[model samples]
Target: MSLEIKEQSEVSPFLSDAARSAAIDNKEKEIKDAQHENDDIMCGFWIFKGPLLQRFATETMYVTIYGVSGCFMAMCFAYFSGTITTLEKRYKIPTKTLGIISVGNDMTTMFGSALIGYYLRKVHRPRWMGIGLFTIVIFCLLNCSLHFIYGAGEDALKLTREFGDLQNITGNLTGSHKDQKLCMSEESTCMQENSIWGPQLILFGAQFILGIGQALFIVIGLAYMDDNTTKSKTPAMLSFSTFLRMLGPAVGYSLASVCLRWYIDPTTEPLIKPEDPRWLGAYWIGWLILAAITFLIACLMTLFPKELPSTRARRLKCEKDDIQNPMDQQMDLSLSGMWCSLKHLATNKVYVYNTFASILYFFGYMVYWIFTPKYIETQYQQSASMATMATGTVALGFSAGGVLLSGYIVSKYQPSARSMAAWNAIVDFLTVAGILCYVVIGCEGSDKLSSMAVTSADSCSASCHCEYVHYAPICSPNNDTYISACHAGCTDNTKDQLGRTLYTGCQCIAPSNSTSVPELQYAVDGPCHVDCFNQFLIFLAVMCFLKLVGASSKSTNLLIALRCIPPEEKSFALGVGSMVASLLGFIPSPIFYGWLIDKYCLVWGKTCSNKGNCWLYDTQALR
Candidate 1:
């Protein structure tokens, strides 16, 4: 019995050592397996599936690509805004028609956002975004193709007569001007040669396609960012992206200013100066640049994996922790499941309130965004290029700064959702008050063209056929502006020392009691001086302030919407919110503002007897 016990004790030690070795081996295998899983992802066997590729699969990399693409997208829109006036002139589109074209994007969003938001939740997000961007590339090319299709209509002053020829001077100015000859002639009606429908349909179609491409940016992009980041870090990341996005407009408007300085058709030299109201800018050049950048962005977006590396790790951990918890289960894809998910959101009061607030805000905000450049041009008599540059540099720059500062504060303090809401409320009230100031701001418009009120038979130059002239104005030294040199009764035109056209022998400059001025009278080219520089400066200051305060709420509002929804419904909520906002806000805002603008038109450029673009606006009524 003693010998058997001694043998068993020695064997027991060997068995125990073997067991410990096996356990250690198993643990080491698990560690290696986990490391392997994290180091590599199953995106594909192509370039997307490499250890080297994994190095770039980070939040920082994602944010960078997203920001640059966002900049390009924003640049396209800003360029459109900057060049809208020139487009109006080039196409002979009235403000009301222009407004209809502007709303085409929102119309698609109003219908498609809900579907995109809900169905795109589990798909490869970056690849889908890439598809959307590709569509945008198409939109850019298509929209700009209009200029190539229809040439920038002939310059208004392109005369067939030789220099010093006075015959047929009282003819239709190229699109926007009229001149009167010393020799009186019978009036003739101009024939309608251009079709407005062609240009209008093309623009609307382009914006509609653009709307489809923009969905990914509005819905998926936000959710992707929030998913990859911690709750506390999300605001900072969003602010960074938005700040970069805002820079796009600044650069875009600056580019517009540069492009507009050149004639509409770069191949041809313009006879009329850019200072003349008839100038058409080179608006198509920027679209080609935007298309090339978007193609590169598309390639980058496709290379990213379905889920980011960090997000994948967290998701795996979460699945393990909540393996038995039904409430933590992933969303269901069945029809009934979707209905239930939607119902859950429908009942969510916080989401409902936040969405309504967004709708109201966007409704009021889009008008200013779409028309500010045109407003600046008409109200202050600033050039289109100057107005666009100012809107982008001063207004959009201050907005970007405000968003960045707000994000920094939120990130540093990690404020609660309620606190964010309270801050937004204060900002909202301040915004309303600031916008009201624009109503009180004022500037005098062009001297009412007295020629329009009188018949040529009763006028000082009774023989002049002024009825057939266009709406181009000529400024007299008396600070009065006539509809045209013909209306001013100028018998001859000559060049000045500075090379500007000078009209001489003007009968219209005589005092009210005198039949005509006996002395030689003269006037210069272009409109009379508008003393609104001081008022414009004040308007700019107010605009800067309003943009600053209004933009501060962007991050806060987004954070509030995110926090109020269930984790799985983040994308769906954003999509639905955007859909509602489009239906109630963006879809109608531009049209309403456009109609209001058309109502104040004092002089419309006539295109074959149909009312065309407004040459002059009632500045007071506009305010």
Candidate 2:
């Protein structure tokens, strides 16, 4: 030790301590600069790479674009859902058929997400996201094209022409003739083979395209944002993005409500008003708007470089640090290694079990997400637009708040894994309870909607087939509801002072008061007022509470899955888990629920010999 100290002292006289320290600092700076240069060199060809444009390429900019893209995606889904009823009526598609159509997006995502997540890990993320957004734009355009391809719908007031012996005789039987919207004695015939399969397949294809875009949004966009942003700020950024996404449903539904108020053709007047059950709205207008917005987003996304400069430096530094204390071997992208990784993930009991739980959870919950608009409209006799707007606004608002509150609670409390699991279980139990409450909270169906096994005919209208009747319900003074004015056996009709069609000489209608003349018994032009406001209120309350409680546990399952796996494998685990959930849960939930809904269909509209869309539902079974 003495000999080493003497040698160091002799050498120290040749070089001052300050000069030596400066030399060491200079060497460290040069190494860091060299690493940064190498990192910059790794970026592939990109737009807006000039220094001026690069100055604006910040994480904040990326998050903004990412959030807006998410919002647009949510809007597309919400708009599709909000207009589902109109689509059903226009296309003569059964609920069950529509259910299967709804799953097309999930089917594609289930098969494609894992592959994309794994193979595209090192690609230019922003450019890929842009490409996905462009695909979505095409999806929107294709959906819009269906409206043009089919043209405006058939007129509801077009009279059914009866040939043979009864043509002239039956034509003069009623003041208002046997139009498509009224009760008639003639049997329905297939004018032409209305090949609904063409439209159905088109819609399914569009949704399938939508799934590809959504997969990119989930697998790439999120990872890119996380990689570029500071870890501590990520949660808040995500919450804000979620908040924006929640707003999308409200905006989308509201837009649908407005668009649906116009006639399907927009340029021409329609026989039926928006309130008429037979009305087909301008549902395609929303898609056009979305397509334009998505195109703009795609352009913006393309402007982003492969990686932000600061993030590149940070990533390089992290790689250097990781080399010193490696926790797991680097990933092998080979086919055998892929199989090995999948097997390893499958063997993780906690991840596997949590995935199963997620599948079940999504299975039960997706039904409501996909069908609540139809449910509200059917059960409460609410207009489609009103039901959609109301549900979207209230439900999404509460859900956003719940998610933010849960994030705050977790951040503040730093709960243990066991506590988080316990909380999730409690949330699940409450969600089940809420669902049960929904089962009992429904209102009675429309009186006119009551299904009769035999034709809806009595002695009053037995002679008038009533079998060919379209759903234009009438309400009598005595509150008796009839399928249509003709079904009520009304011999005459006149316009009231308020321009309302009032029917008299009705055999079916009873006088509200005995003092009224028998011949003066009258009926109105719409269904009897179903008092379901109170019940609807109760349903909304239960639904909001369920959303709040259920969303509170949204992150818990993912957290558990991540903690159970190695850090290097967490991303792969998420991809696999998503695939499993979509395959077992989302892909089939809507189809099954749609079939259940179809089972309660009381009056299936006729399209030739084939069963068309349901005109009326058995409310009791549906509830």
Candidate 3:
């Protein structure tokens, strides 16, 4: 390809001399024209330019807040399954029925995201943002109402029991005598029986709405940035935007943690009986606030001066001119272009290796994010707050390391796309080492709870207990005790036992002198230590890092690829690359993560059980 291009360029280089002077004159004129056009645009955009950063800052803030709210809601939705379990126990609904609803919600959100992406591309940015936010607000309002209804019903149930109205409650609460009989016999026919289903549906619906909002926000924001910035400045602006997007989640999670601590009570029963309902109010409140902010930002987006003069005016002027019609430049959404780009990418050995390595890294990451938090919670028996803090710690490490190292490398080495790819590969390799360390901790059965407690004390209050303890059957030389208690005396205890207590000038007690207690540690366990529940969180975190690296490198590589084409072909090459990424690289991501999680867990379970440590087969052991 290079040789062919060179030969063509040589033939066109006016080696025959007559066209050489003409070509030079044309090039000089083109440069001068381009410079003059740029100056005209710049001068017009600059009159109110000082406030641009302020606008950017405000928009960024709103986006960040909304980003956090969206994530928190998603996590809440994910954890809603736990709420369903509680609701089922209280209301007597079949678990399978609830599972169907949960799965349905996820599917709906996926479709919603794609739909939103398509629409955002089709519509104006402000309209898209407004529509997305409005949808979210409506859905969230419905969700909040559902939660209130459910809570009221639960309150009524308590009121009836307290007032000795149980007998009369049968007819009013249950639909018929048969329902009363079923309620008494099966203990599942309460008025709030379908309460959980409502909120879940609402959440699922809200997720779809939020997904649309997110897609609009990202796509429109990127397009706006691209349209407004100078060509030379676009890459830097995009990179900065990506950085902010990444940072937004971390900041949002941190703020959410603080809010949870301030408003939520972990020890008490949830306001709606099952724990899931407790989070619903808080979740909706966050969404409502975020939705308002999003709406405001959507309104503000209208203030951004349109880059081009009104299209309607231009169309009118064109009609008056009766100019010859330009070629209809329809968007080419074809497989052939994608295939060519894929072929081009594959032919470049460095890019091929980097891309595959990125996929592998993301696979590992998705698994880690999915399982790690649950592993930390179950293995260490820590509180949700603590689990979040632990995960945040790791995330902080990643952010810090990425920022520091990437900046240093960019400053010092000024590496090319291939170099960035190699560096990213190295980071993935190092992440594997971190995972191994976590695995070792899990194997050692070290005190993950105490360690996390200490780590979290800085972020959380001293009174907050973050330890998660799992009680496993301990085989001993003496008669086997049905229950073994490992007590960490962070709080006032009703029972006292013998154990090693580690403390930081606070009254603390550990499980008594029991050898070979089924202990699990997180920091030492690596990715192997993450439990089933947390596998998703681990998987998400890992995938985020890997994707960041891959996407960044890919952008640079695509630019390099564009350079390989003739000047007139550059735009075509770029369009082809984008099509390839959207078609081949985008579609299978979810399926790949799902497969990796299932396969890894299956393998991990088999290995753990076959090695004669059946207790280790527990999903918590990995966390």
Candidate 3 wrong stretches, greater than 4 Å: 1-123, 126-146, 152-197, 262-284, 308-361, 367-372, 397-414, 443-623
Question: What tens-digit string does per-residue lDDT give for candidate 1 at 1-623?
Answer: 67445444434354567775565566667768876665444343354476676678888788878887888888888888888998888777899889889889888887778778888887778888888889889888987899879876643324212311332354433223333333134563553746778888999999998888888777888888888876666888888888888888888888888888877777655556666677777888888888888898888877777677787777678788865423235868677877887899999998999888888888877678778989988888777888888899878899899989998998999888888889888987888898889888876543233233242225565566665456556777766776667666776776789977788777766543444553456777677766667878899999999888888888889888988987678888888888888889998888888999999876666756567788777677677
Q: What is the Cα root-mean-square deviation between model 3 and the actual structure?
A: 16.2
- Give the winner by TM-score: 1 or 3: 1
**C-alpha displacement of 444 in model 1, angstroms?**
3.5
109: Cα error in model 1, Å: 1.1
How many clashes in each candidate? Answer: 1, 0, 45
The TM-score of candidate 2 is 0.84
Q: Per-prediction TM-score, please?
A: 0.85, 0.84, 0.50
Instruction: Judging by TM-score, tell me the better candidate of 1 and 2.
Output: 1
What ranking of all candidate models by TM-score puts the best one first? Answer: 1, 2, 3
Query: What is the descending lDDT order?
Result: 1, 2, 3
Off by over 4 Å in 1: 1-49, 156-185, 323-336, 445-468, 489-500, 504-507, 511-515, 518-522
- Model 3 Cα shift for residue 620 (angstroms): 5.9
Please give the CA lDDT of all the candidate structures.
Answer: 0.76, 0.74, 0.38
| lDDT by residue for model 2 (97-179), tens | 99999988888888877777767766677888988899899889988999889876553323122221243566643433444
Provide the lDDT at 583 for model 2. 93
Model 2 clash pairs are none
